[model samples]
Target: MFYWFLKWVALGPLLRVVFRPQAEGLENIPTDGPAILASNHLSYADWLFMPLTLPRRVSFVAKAEYFTAPGLKGWFQKTFFSGSGQIPIDRSGANAAEGALISAKGVLGKGELFGIYPEGTRSHDGRLYRGKTGVARLALETGVPVIPVAVVGTDVVAPPGKKFGKVTRPQVRFGKPLDFSRYEGLENDRYILRSVTDEIMYEIMTLSGQEYVDMYATRAKAEAKQAEREAAAEKKAS
Candidate 1:
């Protein structure tokens, strides 16, 4: 009820008008039952644009920081994310991966559409990074078909810290459902998990047309921050 209300009454119309997203292969999404919507993370706008285009309620696993923000901005973030049915996951420590898997399994068990960005974090350089194997684990464990989705042009809408930029149209492409049921009962097999994750990433790459990186997005983000700090120190010394 609140989901539809928020979509049609508040967010849906506004986003459609602003982003002017072009979606394809939406029919690939099953009308009912559980499925995983795996996508590549490009920008913060990817969160807004991707869910808005989906006809069904797709719940994503968002970081816990979004829920703990302060002041009015924090309130809005918490409210919007909550209303959108996003699950909050604490991405800290060695247990974080296990915790996320538990949350995802719960969502899938309830016959819901679970949305996940296998890259673990947004791509700072607009290039698709190697996907984490969590997605494959979820699909293999839950026996849910994975739908590869791609969102293009969101990087232009809101890239990194620069928000409220020029309004550029976005495009979302949903690929056919991928079944990894053949690898059933093989969740413990690391080789199978990597193979499945790579296959899904390949499909996302085809849809988004971004260069694939062998490294993880988290690593790339760390490198970017280090470079920024070094540059700042150099300027200070000069």
Candidate 2:
């Protein structure tokens, strides 16, 4: 399949030589069967470099834009993203979050690795943001173990809102698989969902060593922008 081709034959080897990515706790990933890889959202490259270290294919949901571009370049991009295990999801709808969970659950049901960012969005700053509870729901609904993974230094490889940056090596760390079976059949309980999500975030915090911010990244960004506007208005009045 194209996934294996990219992972082992061409792209993987070239990336290994270029980035020289380092990985730890590889033993935590199951050699076979289904598992949820709940990781912190550092940068777009987090998906790339993390999966580069794994022998099994890890699929992540991506915006449909990546596959909808036109022209020859778009064709190549579509092929590459598709081959690299990025599934296109229509994230424009109100039920986008629920849809993503369904897509992830399908992958897990197939006994394949499904990667998700618990933070929902890439952190605007380098610090780790509070994770969304959808990951916990997926884990509970699918009965798959959640592995807290940290892809450090990827923000440098490709910053959140910019093009590729420096060529520094990115480190991928994997924590022990977290079992949440005790909370079985409680997926609908919002309180239980938050608790499980927090536990996963804690493990990611340890692995990533980034400052923990209790606010969601989107809200923080919005608030910061509002503050900036207020400051500008005050300056203008002066």
Candidate 3:
């Protein structure tokens, strides 16, 4: 109820007026079934714009902090996120990955669309990174079609580490659903998982036209920060 109100009456219309989100390949999404939406993570605004283009609600597993923060501002934050179809999960400690998988399974079990960022984290430089195998594992376990999604220009609307950026029209494109039924029983095989993940990333790359980086986004960010630190140290020594 609140989701519909917030989407149709409150926030969706406002965003449509502001960013003017565009979409392509709308027919790729299943009208009434469970499917995993594997997307490239470019910016925080990806979720907002991607779902705005769909008639169905897309649910994502968000960090528990967004729902548990204290005080009035936190209330608004929680309400807004909840109304936007985000499910809260504690993304801390070793069980974080397992927890997200379970939550996603629950959503899919309900025949709802589950959105996942296969890159694990947002790209620091707008280049599509190698996808983590969790998405492949989930698809294999659930036996659902995996849709490759590319959300472009969201970084312009809301770049990493920032709440807002330049105003530009963001475009969301959906590629055809990928079926990995051939590897149905081999979900436990790491090789199969990697192969499936790579295939999904390739589709996303083709759609978004971003340069492909074989490295994971998290590793790339760490290396970038390390290089910055080394440069600073060398400057100090000089």
Q: Which candidate is the best by TM-score?
A: 3
After superposing candidate 3, which stretches have Cα over 4 Å from the reference? none
**lDDT (Cα, tens digit) per residue for candidate 1, span 1-238:** 8778888899889888877888888899898899999998878878777878777788887889989999999999998888888889898768888888998888889898999999988888899999999999999998999999999988888886787667888898999999999999999999999999999999999999999999998898899899999999999999
Tens digit per residue, CA lDDT, model 3, 127-171:
999999999999999999999999999998898889999999999
Cα lDDT of model 2 by residue, 20-51, tens digit: 99999999999999999989887888888999
lDDT value, candidate 1, whole model: 0.89
Which ranges of candidate 1 are over 4 A from the true structure?
Answer: 68-76, 231-238
Sorting all predicted structures by TM-score, with the top scorer first, yields 3, 2, 1
Steric clash pairs (candidate 2): none
Ranking by lDDT: 3, 2, 1
Q: In terms of lDDT, which candidate is stronger, 1 or 2?
A: 2
Q: Whole-model lDDT for model 2 versus the true structure?
A: 0.92
Error of 2 at 209 (Å): 0.9
TM-score of 1: 0.92
- Candidate 2: regions farther than 4 A off: 232-238
Cα RMSD, model 1: 2.0
